[model samples]
Target: DRVQIINDGKFIFSDTIAGLNKQRQAFNLLCTLLAPPSVTSLQKISGVTAVETLSPSQFCLHYQPDLNPTAELLNLAVTQNWQLTELMPEQHSLEDVFMNIIQQEQESATVEQII
Candidate 1:
């Protein structure tokens, strides 16, 4: 059983997956359901794993639970410019950033259609 934080640490998620696809699935589940980063980054890390969506605002990740992978994932967060914690009160969350981008894109589309 692996435990992970989601949505800037607003919720905790857990689950388990079958062989070969376990580790990647866990991470992807967290990103997709909870706090999403860039889709490109998820695609890179998700690679070849299965994912299960939980509630509309949460997710449960299933992975092999490797001790070594913890550090590896941390490194990945750094390299990809992603934050893994929700402890700060002054910073925008990963999800907020993406949501703002989506909003901007939608607004731009609407304005263009009106022109």
Candidate 2:
């Protein structure tokens, strides 16, 4: 569980993601029903935001948030059905991107050295 607040410790939102899979079918159903409404609502909030399906069981939300995307995504998912997965807020900075590239290069170099 995580909490975000704004101004004088007024709570904005809280998020929780379960690490276990208990009701798998319901989870699947929620995902199917979730996309359309989520896309619509998020777009209405921000025109530049977009929802992309990475695979049958994976989705990626690209939003330039004036509001917290994780909180919004969690709200949307729960209203559709009970869900317990981390709604990742995935807007990376330039430094993060470069760090990731550097990490990958280091890992590959280590592997090459081992080989």
Candidate 3:
């Protein structure tokens, strides 16, 4: 089956389920630590695009799907002695995709207004 996503009356995405799944671009890593790692440090890593800190011990690491940094991230955690509690791919449901698209559009619009 196929699905399409529309935002602001504009067609944003059209693809099969598998294709949508392939669009996933992030992983969620939860750890038990005294302090969270530096977001700047993580973003400097190759393929890492963004780091969202859910809490001092939880982070959503966004990266290029093609150049996954999971291995490097895990290695850093081990070298730093972080007690990992959970590490999993970010499951993108249909709603999540739609929201992502909408949020991107909104952010771009805001940037445009500033420019």
Highest lDDT, which number?
3
| Decoy 1 TM-score against native | 0.28
Lowest lDDT block of 10, candidate 1: 19-28
Which lDDT tens digits does candidate 2 get at residues 24-114?
1111112233234444554453323666665544565555534435555566667766343545434345345445545666687699999
TM-score of each: 0.28, 0.38, 0.57
What residue runs in model 2 are displaced by over 4 Å at the alpha carbon?
1-48, 82-84, 91-96, 99-115
Q: Report how far off residue 92 is in candidate 2 (Å).
A: 4.0
Clashes of each: 0, 0, 0
Candidate 3: worst-modelled 10 consecutive residues by lDDT? 25-34
Task: Put down candidate 1 lDDT per residue, 52-107, tens digits, no spaces.
Answer: 44444333333343422344445666776565552111233445544554566668
What's the true lDDT of residue 81 in model 2? 63
Error of 1 at 50 (Å): 3.5
Better of 1 and 3 by TM-score: 3
* Structure candidate 2, residue pairs in collision: none
lDDT per model vs. reference: 0.42, 0.45, 0.72
lDDT of 1 at 81: 57
Best-fitting candidate, measured by TM-score? 3
